[model samples]
Structures are given as C-alpha cells and as structure tokens.
Target: MSCDNCETALENLYLFLDEEIDHASIDEIQAHIDSCSSCLTAYDLERVVKALVSRSCAEKAPEPLRERVLYSIRTVQVQITENRGI
Candidate 1:
C-alpha cells in the first residue's frame, strides 16, 4: 500500500472500527489494513482502546446523582432566563 493509502486509512480508523462508514469505505480500509502491517497494528490498538473506554463507562449514574444534576441544570436555566428578562 502506498503512504497515501495508509494516511487515508488512518484518518478513517475510528469510523472503520465503529462501522460508521459506507460498505465500500469499510472494504477499502480493511484491504489497506490487511496489506499494511503498520496500519493493522494501529487499527488493533484503536480497537482495544475503544473497547476499554466503552466498558469503563458502561455504568449508569446513580438516581440521586442524576436528580441533583437535573436540578442544578434547571436552576441555572431559571437564573439565566431571569437575568435576561425573558
């Protein structure tokens, strides 16, 4: 693969990993990764990092915390509106 292909593949790495791009784009990236060891390694690293972050942030906020946050937001909105005389 040429450096241009590698650069393009790197730019779309996250989209490829997330399957957010079109099928043709996915095939193109996969082909590049299959032919380029460096691209493959980079793709693998990104995949692992994405998985780690997804798992780490899977838990939901506690109900009390959620309520407090909502309350704070409402308070702020009210204050802003009042200040603006809206």
Candidate 2:
C-alpha cells in the first residue's frame, strides 16, 4: 500500500463511514480499503467504533429537558425577531 493511498483512506475514513462524501470519493476509498489489508483493518475498526457510538447515543433526551431546550430556542428566536423589529 502506497503511503498516499493509506493516508487518504485514513484521512477520509470518517466521511466515508458517515456516507458524507461524494460517490466518486466513496468508490475511491472503498477500492483502497478493499485492496489494502491495513486500511481494511482500520476501516473495520472504525466502523465498529462508529456503530457502537451511534448505538450508545441513541437514547432520547428526557421529556422535561427536551421541552426546556425547545422553549429556550423559541425564546431566543422571539428575542432575535423583536430585536430585528420583524
């Protein structure tokens, strides 16, 4: 594995895992991971970590907290609008 390919794959690993990159870039990264054992291992580890994080973060906020946050956001919006005279 060329340093460049491994570097690029590792650098963009997050974007690739999150499906945030363009299709062309995804294809390029996927190809590198498929061909490079080291990158593939890195990719597998990152993927597992990401999945774990996503699962761990899947809990919803408590109802009271959710309501308070929404209220604060709406209050701020109203304040901004009032300040803008709109």
Candidate 3:
C-alpha cells in the first residue's frame, strides 16, 4: 500500500474491525494494515476505544427515565432524524 492507501485504510479501520464492509474491500484493507505500522497502531487504538465504549455503556437505564425518553422521542421524531444526520 502507498502512504495514501494506508492512510485511507487506517481511517476506515473501525469498519474493518466491525466487519462492516464488502469482502473485496475488506481483503484490501486487511492486507494494507498487515504491511503498515502506522495503520497497525491506529487499529490497536481504535480497538481500545471500542472496548472502552462498550464496557462503559453496560449500565442499566432507569425505568421512568426510559419511558420519558421514549415518549419524547415518539413525540419529536424530527430530533431523532437530526441526530441520525439526516
């Protein structure tokens, strides 16, 4: 991989880790990561970030708070669309 290819590959490293891309692109990105140390470091750091996010988000939601949120979300669907970048 050239520096540019490696850079792009690293930028999409999370998608690669989550297996969210097509097979052909996945193969290309994996191969690029295999040969690029900077990309490897990024991959490692991204994995750590995912782990922390997952671990820290394991708490239970309170029932009243959950109901309130669901009610507000149902009443304000536009806000949901906004948060989703639409």
Please write out the lDDT profile of model 1 over residues 1-86, one tens digit for every residue. 13557668878988888889999999999998898766776676666556655665887555675565556545544553454353
Could you tell me the TM-score of candidate 2? 0.63
Candidate 3, position 14, lDDT: 70
Write one digit per residue (lDDT tens) for candidate 3, span 1-86: 23667547855777887888889988898888788665665566566556655665786555675565556534433432333353
Give Cα distance to truth, residue 54, candidate 3, Å: 0.9
Ranking of candidates on lDDT, top first:
2, 1, 3
Model 2 lDDT-worst window of ten: 77-86
Which pairs of residues collide in candidate 1?
Answer: none
Clashes of 3: 0
On TM-score, who's better, 1 or 3? Answer: 1
Summarize candidate 2's per-residue lDDT along 1-86 as a digit string, tens digits.
13457767877988999989999999999998898766676677666556555665787455675565556545544553454353
Q: What TM-score quantifies how close candidate 1 is to the native fold?
A: 0.63
Model 2, CA-based lDDT: 0.69
Candidate 1 Cα deviation (angstroms), residue 61? 16
lDDT of each: 0.69, 0.69, 0.63
Compute the lDDT of residue 43 as modeled in candidate 3: 65
With candidate 3 superimposed using the best TM-score fit, by how many Å does residue 32's alpha carbon deviate from the native? Answer: 0.7
